[model samples]
Target: MIHQIRIDNFKSLVDFEIGLSRFSCLVGLNGAGKSTVLQALDFISQQMRGDIDSWLEQRQWEPRDLGSKLTAKQNVDISVQVETEKHGLIEWSASFNRQSLRCTTEEAFCDGVRLLKVEDAEFWIDRSVKQGSLRDVRSEIMFEYQGSILSQLKRKQIGEPLQALKEVLANIRSLDLLSPEHLRQRTRDSAGHLGLGGQKLSAYLHEQGSEVRQRLLEKLQHAYPQLASIDTRSLRSGWKHLDIAEQFSGKVLSTPARHVNDGLLRLLAVLSQLASDEHFLLFDEIENGINPELVEFLVDALVESEHQVMVTTHSPVILNYLEDEVAKQGVIYLYKNAKGATQSIRLFEIPSLAEKLQFMGPGEAFIDTQLTELATEIQSLSAKGGKDVSAAKR
Candidate 1:
């Protein structure tokens, strides 16, 4: 699990640091930098994959473009400090200039030595000009820009870094911003590979016997009573599909991935990801398109599951269900200041607030206490006249 993240010079995040919990919910209005935080994680993953250049290119800017705009330097530099449960602390930084595309200036520290450095080819340039009576150096270094660190290291028989990168990527999964078609394709694909987003859910089910399938169905039903039973099968020509039988109805309904509603598909996607051995799950707008009553069940499921889940939501129903868990410091609320910088406040840390009151759930207590109009009015009056003004006047 990542205990904390410190971001600097990243897009829309000048300097942001937020402590994370095992199961956290980032709540605020839109453009509050929620998606940007997720994007930072994605940026790290892409960098580890050795697709940093391509990633920047996809952003439609060169290092100089970003650096010139943000830092007023010829090169753009960004750093991410990640504190992990297993790795302790790992700091990764990348810098890019117009002359040099992108360079990995830093990586995981092991035994006082950096594990990796920017390959010369990554900063490939055509020619080097001299200022005075010196000869120009035109030689440059460049590596294959297509493959990730894993692919590059595998070719060189370097396995440790690849394994580490893979582990980190596995721990970070983003299901937000997924298109409808992407969701459907992932559902269909998960039936076979369940890699991520249920990419191979089908293959895993096929490998399991009837007993395993039955046990899984029982567990799913326990988590969601609306689900009667789930059946999966492969077509005669080898296409896999899922059939969901609704409770109280004997009729079995079958449909391809495209026909399922967004809520059900999102649930399945989340469940599939949670079923893995990965420790951390990051969910953006988790309450989107889901039934309100089911939100509690989802929260309860995540709490009971072995993995540590971090979800962002605006639903009061979900917040209410999580109040108890949050009182134990399991929940965090992310908000933006006047300048639009992200800040976090723990619900449990509210002064003069008892655990019992806090556990009454976020809907009636925290949200009402902090965001209600009455509370705001009280605060305004207190600020103007002080707390003793009412008693003294009376």
Candidate 2:
């Protein structure tokens, strides 16, 4: 799982570091760069799959677009250090040159030992030439930066650091489930792991065995008592469509997936993703269309899941619904200063606010502690700066 992340020269993040918990929620006022952070993670997740040049081209991003506009930085650098249970820190960086909009540097390391490091077209791997250390095993790995040099490691017989880094990369997944419309689409594509918008839900859920399907359905039904079961319908073209047994209008109805309410479908999408094998899940606007009352259920599911969930939410009720222990430990507040730079601090680190949470919900505690003033203050010397933010025990 991703233990901590350091982001610099990316979007509105400027230069900031964020720590992660098993499950976390990014709660803050608008324009705090919450969604931008999620976008950056998604970009890296896709880039890790290879074809970095093609990935940037697909989004029509210029060199200037990737770096922080808030500063005149020479490069765009994103580095993540994932901590494994037994092994030590594993790091990755696909740094880009701001002028050329090209990846000038890419590297990965395990326990401070270099696994792969690329500069332009040149790279070094673990020693295989029977000459020197792994860092001395140099090779040419550039295809005009179209993909990662790590892909080459996969093809060759690599060991340790590279294999460990590969597993870490595989665990990173970003989910964008805001589109209820996509979930309702008629798709022929394999319902592999629940895709970005859950568009492939029908295909994926249909392919699961009866036991797995029943287990997930039971969990979903627990949160939404109205739901009886989820099953697939055979369409004329030999394709299957998702349908759910729901008790509505005083009668049980087998509703087509497309016809179901957006809230139900969105929750269903989240459920499928949580049930999958992915370890790291990044979600933007996690409370989009769900009923407010069920917010706790969503929070509960995420916090209890085996996966490490990172999500952004505009809903204070979502934060308020969290239990004291979960709220104090799992919430990370994102705030924007007058100049529009984003900063983050976990609630557990703030003693004053943490104490207030024992008596009030997160929403009330936020207001009472003068955080609102700090966010909008033009020259706040107290509890406003990125790393120096403080509260004098209201």
Per-model C-alpha lDDT, please? 0.52, 0.70
lDDT of 1 by residue, 275-309 (tens): 65565676777887678867877787776677767
Q: Please, what are the lDDT tens digits per residue for candidate 2 over residues 293-360?
A: 88889988888889988888876777776777777666887776555677776754566666777778
- Candidate no. 2 TM-score: 0.84
Q: Compare the candidates by lDDT and give the number of the best one.
A: 2
Any runs in candidate 2 off by more than 4 Å, and if so which? 53-64, 97-102, 127-132, 142-147, 155-157, 233-240, 247-252, 348-352, 367-371, 376-394
User: Model 1: what TM-score?
Assistant: 0.68
Worst 10 residues of 2 by lDDT: 385-394
When summed lDDT is taken over every stretch of 10 residues in candidate 1, the lowest stretch is: 125-134
